[model samples]
Target: MSLGDDHGYGDSARTDASGEYGGTGTTRTRLPESGPYGGARRGRSSSRSLVTVVGVVVLLIAAIAFANRGDGDSGGAPDTADKPDTAPTAASGTDPVKSSTAGVPTGYSQSEQGAQSAATNYAVALGSTGMFRKADRHALLDALFTRDAAARLKGPMDQAYSTGFLDSMGLDENGDPPEGSTFVSRVSPMGTTVEEYTDTTAKVAVWYVGLIGMSGERSTDPVTSTWKTWTFDLSWTDGDWKIVEDAQTDGPAPVPGDDRAATSDEISKAIEEYGGFTYAR
Candidate 1:
């Protein structure tokens, strides 16, 4: 797994110990070898959209099933014509932690909600601008992953974020953008689901949208949006959840809205002004 800027987004076509992001219909098993930005090579953008639609349908069915078993009572008959607005069915009444370890959220509960929280927070951290730097990246992985997983991933990850990759992103050897340039790479979790759960282990999938690129007049790689589902296999270790394994797949994206894309300056300013959240489910 590489800590490079191009690691998490599904734009790549290659896979490694680091997670892979697939396109709409096809699975991207690895990072792209084409260039530093991993420009989209898949000719099937429409097919990828269809796959996202199908994935959404599957998630809806699962959500319905889960809702039916709430409070130990069978949910009432389905009302297709008068379906309620989409919203979270269960609320744990728990607030997110106000503290963090090395800028990563901690203190998750031992329930499914906690698992989802851990996955979403981890997604954000893994997708941040900090991943481009070796020192920050190492600290992040150490904080989020189990000791064994971190140890196994360190070497491959270091290799992935080699000098060549950083140079490709127009960053200096230290992974810093040129003066007056802002490198933006951030992940925003839209929703989360618990795929599997037990007392000690949990599998959670975070549906998120990410922004990646350098925002500056001299920048060759411009910021762009990507939708993906990041699945994390977590262990309840010590007093917090830690990742043992993780993977990314193409999105469960909804149809695009009529919103216009923001300008580079606007994106850069927003990134600087806004702080990330400690997401809770």
Candidate 2:
């Protein structure tokens, strides 16, 4: 599927792997100017207002559900929720190659399962805090994408995380978090599905929850979670599956739970103490 079909907030669309950067009359995925989810940052007032409205709507729905629970209407459809059918612990019957390039898992087998693995891992990399830093972002692009795609994206990606953008997010010119603040940007894949597969090309969708923003006592943008589905078009290139193009959508988000939000210090400590894993099916 073409990446440009949708352009919602936090969405990105890129040219195909074979397309040249500004030479083949093709468009590249434009990263947003602000926000940790790769979108133009919203004003605090607007964001807070939207959140309040959504919270009220959710509470009203819950209250209505509770009031109607005993009305004897038990024929409602099941909540499929667009989640994966299999459990996370179930084996996929594939042994992933324990190889990596520049800290990203690599050497995936040329199969549908391998494509799913690669897509999910690449999603994590693309949504990472490293993407906010120039050097680390360049390294990740080089490692996770085709050579042409990496070269094509460097300029635009750099602009997206420009100095002005960093300052807007309270980061320094070097994209470092402010002292006493911990910047958070992490992607946790809930599941993956292969949309279409061929011998040399595969398209996979990764449903994930991402945590982003800064954690600190004086932070204006406290860490928040977002749900999104990242669709990757991958090609088996140079002995590994590399990203060709990709797109993202809001989500098939589940109902919000009643868990309390953690403190900034708690979030900072947890981020430092917990290590991420190399996801393999």
Candidate 3:
């Protein structure tokens, strides 16, 4: 499964995602520039109006570019990585994958189990709320993505968290609470497997789900769920599956059940009142 196949907004196609920078549509019209002396005045007015439109377009382009800059990269379906220098030398490199509930990884490794462990754990971290905060986002990319990719991602990711994005989700321009609303964005890994592996690199597939959107009465689209498979093209840069690139797309999704959806208030309270988990497998 490719990373683009993910289920949440992170998913390339199947998920419902909107970044703060760009409004959902992309169509645009050009402004009139010819002078209107008789038509001169008319022309000037048209030009000014068009100029204003151009300005909005420029801002939109910049915003979308910034907001959508994330880790998912492409290099075809995951293939095996380069060979390691030493023969499985008594299980070296980083500590074992740490766990919180049962599937989360605190820190993981490169062994078979370790690969799966790392993928699952990393998925949770990559999909969590931390990816939105500057300090937390930095901590996560450094901890999860490949060093080079992480460096490229830092600034763009920050810009993507624009005030407009917050407003779209019914959040304050800073993604903080408005006294009553709660923001909900989370990921939970279900299973994992090493799609590609070698001593120097490993491609791990993490199948999981995510919950997103505003959590209050004001939200038009309340929280929703999606399933996706995120494939990581990791290089053993330092140690671990330091993601060089990744991609996402829709499920492997199961058909929907006939269950009643939660109320906006219920969802809000759950998000505001509840906390997320620390995973390990």
**Which 10 successive residues of model 2 have the least lDDT summed?**
1-10
RMSD of each: 8.6, 7.3, 19.7
Tens digits of per-residue lDDT for model 2 on 27-53? Answer: 234454346664322333335567779
lDDT per model vs. reference: 0.69, 0.71, 0.52
> Where does model 2 exceed 4 Å of error?
1-30, 38-93
> Candidate 1 overall Cα lDDT vs. reference?
0.69
* Candidate 1 Cα deviation (angstroms), residue 234: 0.4
Candidate 1 lDDT, 136-225, residue by residue in tens: 878987898887666555555566566877787777878899999998877888888888899899988888777777898877878866
Number of the top-ranking candidate, with lDDT as the measure: 2
For candidate 1, give the lDDT of residue 236: 96
> Residue-wise lDDT of candidate 3 within 66-115, one digit each (tens)?
99876777545666579543233233344565443222344455566566
Q: What is the lDDT of residue 269 in candidate 1?
A: 92
Candidate 1 backbone clash number: 8
After superposition, the stretches of candidate 1 with alpha carbons farther than 4 Å from their true spots are: 1-76, 79-91
